[model samples]
Target: MVIQSGESSFGRDSVTRATSPFLPPPVTHRKDCMSAAVKRYRYLRRLFKFEQMDFEFALWQMMYLFVAPQKVYRNFHYRKETKSQFARDDPAFLVLLSFWLFVSSVGFTFVLGLGVYEFCKFLLYVIFVDCIGVGLCVATVLWYVSNKYFLKPNYRGQDVEWGYAFDVHLNAFFPPLIILHVLQLFFYHGLPILHRTQVLLYPLVPLFLTFIVSLASGWNIIRTIMDFYHYRV
Candidate 1:
């Protein structure tokens, strides 16, 4: 009886150990999966924070560029022309204008080169900056044309009524300019200077800026034209 009891007890102990191995492995696997998930989440959170910081920095940089001495010089020169026709017809003014046009064109070409390089190198931040630069170039061109032809003619009129024509022109120019400038802040300054990552995000910056400018321009044109029509009647 003692021998039989001993053998049965040993068999029961062996069965219990066999089942315990299977149970522990499943529990271990679950723990490992959870740990991996937690690690991935943390990594993603850090990446997002980094990107946000980059964007903010880029924005500050763009503002600084826009308000720099060169920008002031340009603005003053343009405004002076509007007030005094002397500056308008001056050969020097044309030379300066030509210089600016050439500079801007060169800058735009450089931006394109940089953007392509960044895209190839997988540097997202640089790409974004390039995009912003392109947008600024476009905005500058639009501003020049609007100021030279549209705003100047109206302001030059001896009895220029502050009527629909004036309103429409201002409306058309200001809204698009503002929108493009805002986009420039995001694409050129925010993404590249701040984040310093040359990633896919850079390309989107230009596209967004362009979209905003186009939308604003279209809306302003329609609104201004409608206002002029109403005033005429």
Candidate 2:
């Protein structure tokens, strides 16, 4: 009787194993989607290696750096512990981010300005002259800061990476650029439409927010600079 009972249990186990799927259909689909996303992210990261250390993480770090630069600053300095050095101190990342921001500002400028065409001549000029010029200026400024400030004598012997300086400068500059673009958006249309509606005061909301963001960005930059100074000396 005991032998028969054991055989019955074994038969049931085999049947269950044969009928049950390894994973539910929803779970399998989700896993496959996640894997594909990871693969795509890796491919993009490799393609843009110089400018984007990690495609997704860089965006998040930029967001964090704007809001909490000190944390990102420290993480960059102490990379061994934090393992976030790539996102913060990648030279290509800085160049690309700076260029991206510059392009965004330029695009917004074009949108806010007269929607007129100059036989593609003015567009070419803005793309080649204004965008490239602004990008180069940002790079030069970051390079200057790297050499002038962070590379100075360090009493604590904590070495400063040039890339980190660039990262800090990029983060410091991003807020003002972003806020200025937003302000331009409101200044361009919101006020004009509100004025037409006779709602003169409503337009101040976006302007006020932009002003506050600009101030916050400046403060964040000051905090980052102070942190760098402390790290230096």
Candidate 3:
């Protein structure tokens, strides 16, 4: 009888142990989930604010960078197409490149003539001009690539339309030149008072403008390329 009782007690304990694992415990608030949700909300809010600030800043900067100058040099000639099938053999871009190099060299020489007080001024001018020229050359190469591979069908009226690509290329190429010329006039002609702070800020304005324009243009190109790929697929 004692053995039977011991066996019965062991079986009951075993049954309780087995049931306890399967049964749900008393309800407890999950602090971890609540904390994670709060973190996610705060992160999203921060991201939204950042995006808004970026847009506002870019808009303000772009207006000062592009629009004000447009009023001054509205008559400037902008070359839209440097290469087409009819002009495939033309060396116009090469000539333009050579001309820019010569002009840049002359500018550098002038900058070199200035004494210590004006060295920074000259250096800033040269840097801005060179960056603009380099950007133009790069835009030309991208234009050619787009024309050859991406725009060919549109040119032939076969299927693809790359009008947007052409427009983007044009938009990307012109601003740098405009900014360069504006800065050149601003510094060389002494239109703006040459405070030390102004001198430093002046070059930065154009450089920043160039950077933003390039970024926007690159984004457009990438989107277009992706669209083309998607369409082809």
For candidate 1, the 10 contiguous residues with the lowest summed lDDT are 85-94
Worst-scoring 10-residue span by lDDT in model 2: 1-10
Tens-place lDDT per residue, model 1, 99-179, is: 333344345445556565544443333233333345445555655565566665546532222221222232233334334
Ordering by TM-score: 2, 3, 1
Error of 3 at 196 (Å): 5.1
Ranking by lDDT: 2, 3, 1
Which candidate has the highest TM-score of all? 2
Better of 2 and 3 by TM-score: 2
Against the unseen true structure, what C-alpha lDDT does each candidate score?
Answer: 0.38, 0.50, 0.41
Candidate 2 lDDT over 63-147, as tens digits, reads 7666666644544433422232222323434455656655665566577563445424554654455444554567567667655
* Candidate of highest lDDT: 2
lDDT of 3 by residue, 143-183 (tens): 56755687554455322223323223333444564456434
- In candidate 1, how many Å is residue 66 off? 11
Return the TM-score for candidate 1, rounded to 2 decimals: 0.19
TM-score of every model?
A: 0.19, 0.41, 0.26
